[model samples]
Target chain A: MDITINRGDFVGLLGPSGSGKTTLIKTILGATDVYGGEVRVEGQSIAERRPRVGYVPQLETIDWNFPVTVEQVVTMGRVRRGWWYPWQRREDRLVAHEMMSRLGIADFAARHVRELSGGQKQRALLARALVSSPRLLLLDEPTSGVDIKTRDEIMHLLDELNHQDVTVIMTTHEINAVAAHLPWVVCLNGGIVDSGPPADVFTPDTLRRTYNADILVTEYMGMKLVAESPHFFGRNERGSADSSERGEHVHAASV
Target chain B: MFTPLQYEFFVRALIVATLVGGLCGLIGVYVVLRRMSYIGHGLSHAIFGGAVASYVLSVNFFLGASVWGFVSALLINLATRKRSISADAAIGIVTTSSFALGVALISRFRSFTRSFDAALFGNILGITQADVIAIAAVALLAAAALFVGYKYLLFTTFEPEVARFYGVPAGWTDAGFSLLLAAVIVVSLQVLGVTMIAAAIVIPPVVARLLTDEFARMLLLSVVIGALCGLGGLYMSFYLDISSGASVVLFSAAVFLIALSYTTLRSRLGSARWRRRSAASGKLEPFH
Candidate 1:
């Protein structure tokens, strides 16, 4: 897929499980090798320029049992600065403090990271990624396990960061969370099934092609949402409501 | 304390202990944080075969052990990456196989000297000035590696995926860390020997964790605690006529227990004071 992310755009990668959303984001961050296509950030190939890319990985991937404080966690973003000095400058610490406060996690700065709630931990991770002040921010499944309120809060935080002109590119299973807020959307399953605005790409035909399951797309409160039918074989009908309530249900059905 | 020759040995032992202890404490922070403590045990024991091979060939023991350690480290890294075997299983495999190899090598040498026993249990009194210099060099290199890779190391230790995403080269970080650990193992073999060196690497950091929440401060405290254990162990060996290596380990364990108890008591007292203050202000809430 050939796509360009501008300096201040908030782009959401929307796709089902096993889709190549993560691969696309990883390619852009230069974490995954690109075989044929090119991923350019700020008119330069990521492989050539090696631009600063702040990444917030899915929280479930972290081992919370590892003992570390919130401040120490946030300070990890500045690791690429230099080798001889390990200490963060006063300005770095101040910026971390500001980021923590911005994320509403200032009270938990001195607390052990394992003691944080799910939302708080997500915010802490986001704060850590933001401390480096990268030109581009890439997040993988940022709201995968979060509740609806927390998911909206996280998206709002990203929106605020985007307002500050930090380019945001996030891959998430939570399509409804981005349908109303994100400026651009890419729906992919192994390859780009469709790419455009959320309203344009989140169609019944696109959803069916992406997930290989019969899905129904409906409009709720001026927003597009996917609903998988109970008659569909192998589809967990019970999970749809729970997932939809969490704003993460993306339904695609095979004919 | 008064004899010149005895004092020279004592000073040499002190220098060796400090160098080994300080480096172990410093690097042990990363090991403990990364939850790779078993790697210490695995590498220390695996180097025994190399030590025995050196003895058989009449070569420098440090060089032999380092070669063995590097090989074992590389093998462990490769096996863990390539095969589906868990880290503990890899450690078990390398340590037992190498230890058995060392034992078999020792059995082949029929001279039946006390040097083999010394290598197993370690004899701090036998520490030479040359050993002290070698230990210092190893410690210096370990310190330099830690200093240069401190941030990346911290990043990898805490959030490896995120570190990789930021282009921190997690693979190289792990390899560099493993190499540093092998170096520590080789140097520590002088005083801690093949069998007991893992304790020297572990106990101080475990004890230091009780005293501080900050990583940097914890490192400093561990080093101090390790140095004291080494010095006190030597003193105990001289005065009470105990095994120096065992005495050192015992001193460190004792420090760990004391620190644990002290921290527990302090926290209890502090919580009690907070409760009393809150109760006096009529703002105390009932415990759930």
Candidate 2:
């Protein structure tokens, strides 16, 4: 649908699988055909400018067996006009090293991306995205599957980048862990259901419209937390859910 | 080696083999990384169909075969652009159909199959001065294209979907690469043979992969290894009176076995030492 993201906006897109979250991200990156309307940076045509969008894709989409080092992946961001020659210039290497150091992946520069831990691999991909220093950054499920500590680290890094005036937009399913803390979020299902501060946009009706299922929301320490309707989660601490009830829970969760 | 050089035919064969070796290795990096290994095998056979058609039409073999193969490859590229059909499926569909056409034509002109012996299994003895120049010309074209498009190639190979996000002209890259692949197959027909070309293209890159974790090193190593194997196989063929194509592939296979053994042992020893160090320091294993 129609949306406007201002400079330094730290926005999260929340939606279910196949709800066009990743497709919207691809549309922004010009990876998909723009049939009806145009995407612009400010008022200028994106085509007029050089291709410099920074994208951090989902880790699940990566091929870990591919032979690439941290250094190599980072320099991949600089695959633009200046790289007409085969080898990387001294400045390319310097920029890659600087980005890696900033991301705390310098120690793993020579290591294969395959050998890295989950968070470390995310950081490597982040370093590659940021090496070009674009004004905008788009991440697809950046914090997905990460432990709490690693997730916090990555969020803080994104926060730090946002404070420096880089517009950050990420699509994620971790509504509680990630989208809850975002300054703004869009609840999307093919089109924008609603968008505002998390407390305002993450309403039960909006979430149900987005996920096609009832969801539970609560506030803790002034932050809104979301969970699947506990009627479907599992047995409570006291084992209240019966065997048939647990089977129902599994089916509901699958849905 | 010195004795073979005295004969002009041997010298021509040696030069063409070396060039084809390097070219195949260079392209093999992309082929293997993209998991399009079968395209090399399939496209070479498809190009053979074009070669057969060229003979019947009284067209220049290189020109006709290259165009036909290029068109076939582009169809495959376009077919897989949406990724509805996997790379293997696209290659198989196009290659088999094209090959079937060749078979149909051959039945009509029975004499055509006689000439195809050189193409099917390679005839290093048939390499002429013109073949030498054609192979070298294609090699230069390939080197220039690779040189200019190195970053795009690496980015595309590493992440095909993301490469488009960064302004890589994916369609053009695929089409250009298809043309190069067609030319490579056409030029290599006299030396590597259609049936054996896939092995030449696969072995060098795979061996390089086993030896290194770095992409740049793998690229360089594959080229060097391919060229050396080409030279070595030619020497062996001269002495052993074996098919040069077979000799080259057998040499590459031997090298692959050595590399596989070395890497496997290194990884085992490396893990063992890592375990020992972790126990000594009472630290948990870092990698899961």
Error of 2 at B109 (Å): 4.0
Q: Residue-wise lDDT of candidate 2 within A134-156, one digit each (tens)?
A: 78999999998788999999999
**Model 2 steric clash pairs:** none
Clashing pairs in 1: A212-A254, A213-A252, A213-A253, A213-A254, A214-A253, A214-A254
C-alpha positional error of residue A212 in candidate 1 after TM-score superposition, expressed in Å: 5.4
Q: What is the TM-score of chain A alone in each candidate?
A: 0.84, 0.87
Give the lDDT of residue B74 in candidate 2. Answer: 90
B1-288, model 1: which lDDT tens digit per residue? Answer: 545226767777766666677777878888888777888888888988887777788878788888888889888877877458987899889877998898898798865355766677678888777777877887778877777777788889887656876668798998888878888888777677666777878889988888877777777888888888887776766677766677777777788889889999999998888788777877766442
Query: TM-score for the first chain of model 2?
Result: 0.87
lDDT of each: 0.79, 0.86
Q: Give the best candidate by DockQ.
A: 2
